[model samples]
Target: MSAPLIVGSVAYTPNVVTIWEGIRDYFAGSPAEMDFVLFSNYGRQVDALLQGTIDLAWNTNLAWVRTVAQTKGACRALAMRDTDTVFRTMFVARAGSGLGGLEDLTGRRLALGSRDSAQAAILPVHFLTRAGLTPGEVDFLRIDSDVGKHGDTGRSELDALRAVLDDRADAAAIGINTWEAIGRDELMPGALELFWESPVYSHCNFTALPALSEERATPWVEHLLGMDWDNPAHRPILEMEGLRRWVVPRLEGYASLFEAVREQQIGSRW
Candidate 1:
């Protein structure tokens, strides 16, 4: 068989399985011309993208920034989900815990989502630094779920939520959609409260090395944007990802996130 499209991303199990299979199904109608592969983390996924083991990838904001920096913008953002826009990361605490803001986190144990998470870790650290709180000043524990997906893996956020529920942490960092997903699951809705929210930024988008020609890339992205959210075939996937539709790709929407990752470089050791 010809080479598969070699999609790379984390497997978010029941909630995010739609991300992989849904995109595959969308491309399946193209005369069976493409196929995909999934990865558990974004670091390795990006490595594969650079090494040519994969043709394209669904990259997190941080990974896209790294990809652009590494490739000098030789890669391209193909498409993204509509819900990926206006996304925020939230700081949460147990109800009645009396925590007012990040300042209160001083000397307290805080649960961060993932080491590679943009929302839960990167941006949070950047904002924290802006507020004059440096890393290692507080007790920071990481709930590492989707390493390569860069905390788009809701599993890490879920772990932080549970830590707050069980009284293990004074507060936790989580993506807003992940927090909402927990509410849908009836997980401690009233027991937890949002203490702080990061400014809006974009999330996931398709990143590919510049080898794929525009002729092939155009239809691949067009098919994704053209997916009908109301159609039965696409509805289940849309619900699973907490979105109504996908959108045309844009990197400018994520410039703030890229800048955050660049300025903070919290996990440069990685």
Candidate 2:
């Protein structure tokens, strides 16, 4: 029997262990069985994937961009969550700021998350620049509370919001997931209001180097895509992982991030 393929993922949350364990069990007795190893951060996970210690990596979009930069187009994305395809950045302000759009952000203090956060940091700047807002017009408050995880912890985004709430900033940029997680609009009522949001972009994916053969990779991806949302056994894991289904990687969704990373000159390591 072939040795089980090893997958790498960052332990961003406590429930990550449960999610991967359930996935491994689902692949049991399959044509391409698998296992996983958790890392302290995405940098370590990406290193494992590059060093041939892991056949696949569950990578954040920032990690994916770095991998492509490091590998020079030698790597390929196998699959991504359905939610990832439509991921977006949210710009919010305390209620009654009268900030309706990016154009209103000029001369305002804007809080951003970790420097490495594509959703909360990099992409927000890109969107602003595209809107013709220059750095001189905006006062930026950067919160690098969770730097190494690339804002996977969501702590940074939360901190950015805190800056806005505490009157340290007039506005904040955060990921849609963080916005939903906080339930700010409903729970906080008039505490905060979203004024601007970026176009949909990709968030995370299963990345693999060319060293992993298609014969081995294909079956694993097929089995992964087989996970049904309606299945009783798969539903909990799906819910915990925040996805309704796995789909082929939407390479187009990553285009904006790639451009942002390039324009920002974000490097692979923190």
TM-score for each prediction?
Answer: 0.85, 0.98
In the range 188-238, model 2's lDDT, one tens digit per residue, is: 988999998899999999999999999999999999999999999999999
Given candidate 2, what's the lDDT at residue 70? 93
User: Model 2 compared with the native: what TM-score?
Assistant: 0.98
User: Per-residue lDDT for 18-90 in model 1, tens only?
Assistant: 5667768777757324566666667777888899887788877888888888888788888787877778878
Steric collisions counted per model: 3, 0
C-alpha positional error of residue 104 in candidate 2 after TM-score superposition, expressed in Å:
0.9
Question: Which 10-residue span in candidate 1 carries the lowest summed lDDT?
Answer: 261-270
Name the regions of candidate 1 deviating beyond 4 angstroms: 1-6, 14-22, 29-32, 135-137, 184-190, 266-270
Q: What is the C-alpha RMSD of each candidate to the true structure, in Å?
A: 3.1, 0.9
Model 1 CA lDDT for position 171: 88
Candidate 1 has a TM-score of 0.85
> Relative to the true structure, how large is the alpha-carbon lDDT of every model?
0.76, 0.93
